[model samples]
Target: MTPDRHRLHDHLLDPSGGLVYHLRALRHRHGRWAPFHRVLAGWLAGWQPGRRELVIVGPSAGYGLPTGFLARFGRVTALEPDPLARWLLARRPDAGRLGFDRLDCLAGTDGLARLAAAHPQAAILFSNVLGQLPAPGGDWRPLLARHLAGHAWASYHDVISTTTAPKPDCAGLGVSDDGSLEAVLARFWPGGTLPLTDHDTFRLGGERPRRYAVWQIARRRWHLVEWADNTGAAPHG
Candidate 1:
């Protein structure tokens, strides 16, 4: 699966700029939020923290992560093909440890190899990025499988409604009857049930906050050794 060469990507290549949010800030508190950042931290907490290699995919704008979360790794590498986002990331503090590489996994499998080659152990953090990277015929299992074959992998993204856009009042992201993930997981694990778990349902903006309360749902932790232990989406509307 390479980068989506469609019109959306064309908008990302231009050397423009934008602010990158911490991502965790979106959790619904009194009313609105999608605290993906907090959810990811909790899931990752189950595993070893201090390690050597951690690769971040599609780090748009920079705040895809911070030196604090990455303190465990000796060095962190980010694969972002968008010059606009990369340019913004360069200005971030601790930029030295956060190496930059315009790796377009959307282009092909080579980029995946480059990431997998990380020494010791390599974990992938698809922090709010993958869903945007057009999947081949709308399937993301292959990529997840490959990454899982290496080290622990995690993904956080917007769970768009298959039928229509989200409503204004819906605050939490629960597992609907939509076999959104099951269908994809089946492609790799065959009869395996997708390891999904519910994340925090928080209200952002305090009381009478900005938007609806958002719920974070993600996969259970799994890494590569024991068939792998591993691991969205909203762009603030």
Candidate 2:
């Protein structure tokens, strides 16, 4: 397998690497992740792309993805790095509709464009992996907007994370780039503030309305997950 070039730090490596996230999912999918799964499913259900093929990047074990959702596409390929996740993701009930790819599509300067060229008819999805990736001089968003201009795409990723539990009401909130990260964090943690990590995803959605949710990935760690879709929009040039 090709080495990943995204340069994620150890703390941010767990999910993309697979083992840690798989183990956590086994323990929390039915508990902590239940609400998130529901919200994510609802968000996904609203997306109806014209293509029947789907290419999901970094969908670790697909714990947050619903089998019914996978069934929506005639062909679903998972571009993941974690061996364990690839193994588990393939065995999903809708395994018949799924395939695996070894390409590290985010590994090089033109990787995304290359991937787009390779699967011109497939809808691309950045599955909860964006927040875990380093910003590469804070150019990630622009890079995506530019390269994926003519494709049907969507992404659900982390925007902010903290040890403190955010308000449950923050789930399903619509986030915008106009607000300060501090303002967004304040709404989620109205009781008080705590040390946090901004996942550099705050404005990935631009002024687009994004579905937001809180994910308690661990007992003490929580993440602000944001979802955006462009399946219905005309391709941006």
Candidate 3:
């Protein structure tokens, strides 16, 4: 998959910006990203699907993901389009634990459907990708709800972000899933004086329980991350 045609973006950055993101992740994986990674790992541990096969969409180098989590599946497929990221992911610690498969899910409208058709028993995951999608064509929540209806699925993506948003209280490990984005933001960034840009991911989760966390993706930019799992749910029409 070519960079412009099918490569994924690195949230507000172009497809080529993935390299920069990878560098930043390597620099901050144990420093700035420590708190968020801890919370993410805990959240991942909570996801227990019955299927042995798994599909991870847009996981760039598996930086924020724990290797132990990926090893839980008997078979793991990474539906990534970035060539560089695919290479880096293969070298991650204990990469040998997973039986990997690669595909470009962003290549066409039916990519997701086709994946489901090909691996009907596999559980699907959107790994911090939904929020980074370019507007107009980036809205895949509806398609996901429609196409992967019968399968177990989970995702954690940006709900909103701003260069002025304050740092989150990562003193804890659990996410607060009590209210709307406004309420959650108020709890996370109380006394915020600047307006926030909604990532349009708020419409997801569809009344299901959602967990919220704060991520300082950059020194000045902060993202309110949201996670949800739709397991054992009926197919959407």
lDDT of each: 0.42, 0.74, 0.73
Q: TM-score per candidate, in order?
A: 0.52, 0.85, 0.84
Superposed model 3: Cα runs more than 4 Å off: 1-17, 97-102, 107-109, 135-138, 167-173, 233-237
lDDT of 1 by residue, 104-194 (tens): 5544444444456532265666655544445543445555455445455555543331322233333232221222333422322335333
For each of the candidates, the C-alpha root-mean-square deviation to the true structure, in angstroms, is 13.1, 4.0, 4.3
lDDT of 3 by residue, 19-80 (tens): 68877887878887878888998888888877777888888778888867777877788866
Deviation in Å, model 2, residue 117 alpha carbon: 1.0
Choose 1 or 2, whichever is better by TM-score. Answer: 2
Q: Find the candidate with the highest lDDT and give its number.
A: 2
Residue-level lDDT of model 2, residues 3-48, one tens digit each, is: 3553312222464555677678888889977877888887788877
* Window of ten residues with lowest summed lDDT in model 1: 201-210
